[model samples]
Target: MGSIVLTHLKSAWHVDQAILDDEEKIVVLRFGKTTDAAVMAMDEHLSKIADRVQNFASIYVVDNKEVPDFNAMYELYDACTVMFFFRNKHILVDCGTGNNNKINFSIADKQDLIDIIEVVYRGARKGKGLVVSPKDYATQMKY
Candidate 1:
């Protein structure tokens, strides 16, 4: 497991490492906030969850500077928000409001992360691209 810290909009966030290990893609847990305390709190919460999972993991914080070699799957253009990505695909989690300002996870537990890895890896093997929304894929169709 590896991790990286990045800064965005003057807020510091620690997120999961973006390394691919043993064919298992890394999970990126992003935390964004205007205040440092709130960001730290979110980090603590995610750390606790990661501890419980006992899976290979890393963490990072998002910032304004674009991370080299890192591809963005989704962008939460609002206040402090947390986002997770596996194998370049966004992990859709339910966080009540469904807004981009809060942390949400619908998959229940860490096992879900593992499941995402397996599914994404399998799809890649079959040359099946990740399923994205029609609007998001409109440009591809144009080609």
Candidate 2:
């Protein structure tokens, strides 16, 4: 239900404009199949926190099938990928997952996603292209 309400980027032009139009706040793009379970989970988490982080971030969902323009450039081959951009510059987050490009997995916790957005927002405002996540995904214990 949470995933259903989030904004979706319909075309390559909309995606490009989304990245180019935002002068402030982090542009969070989730690129993947909207029907996939993982993507749905991530989208749910994103939607829940969209308003909480609106001042610092903007979340947009882009269907991989609809916009393949960034697949190769961003290496978005995973089931669900979340990337960040600030002032038209790509913002990388060190999630301790060994991959700093984009979040390629589903994050279930809304607070966890919020923390990450906060970190990314702070780093972006500081003129840093990359920032360390509040929690280390690589070291977090999984059940």
RMSD of each: 10.1, 2.0
Consecutive 10-residue window with the lowest summed lDDT within model 1: 134-143
lDDT leader: 2
Residues 15-108 of candidate 1 have per-residue lDDT tens digits of 3224233234435445444244445554445554555333443345564233322223345443334554555445443323434222432332
lDDT per residue, candidate 2, 1-143, as tens digits?
A: 68776789999899989989999889999999888888888888898899899998889999998889889999988888999999999999999989898888667888999999999999999999989998889954321
| Steric clash pairs (candidate 2) | none
Candidate closest to the true structure, highest TM-score: 2
Candidate 1: regions farther than 4 A off: 1-26, 33-35, 54-57, 64-79, 100-143
Please provide TM-scores, in order, for all candidate models, with all chains considered together.
Answer: 0.43, 0.94
**Candidate 1 has what TM-score?**
0.43
Deviation from native of the Cα of residue 91 in model 1, angstroms? 1.6
True lDDT of residue 15, candidate 2: 90
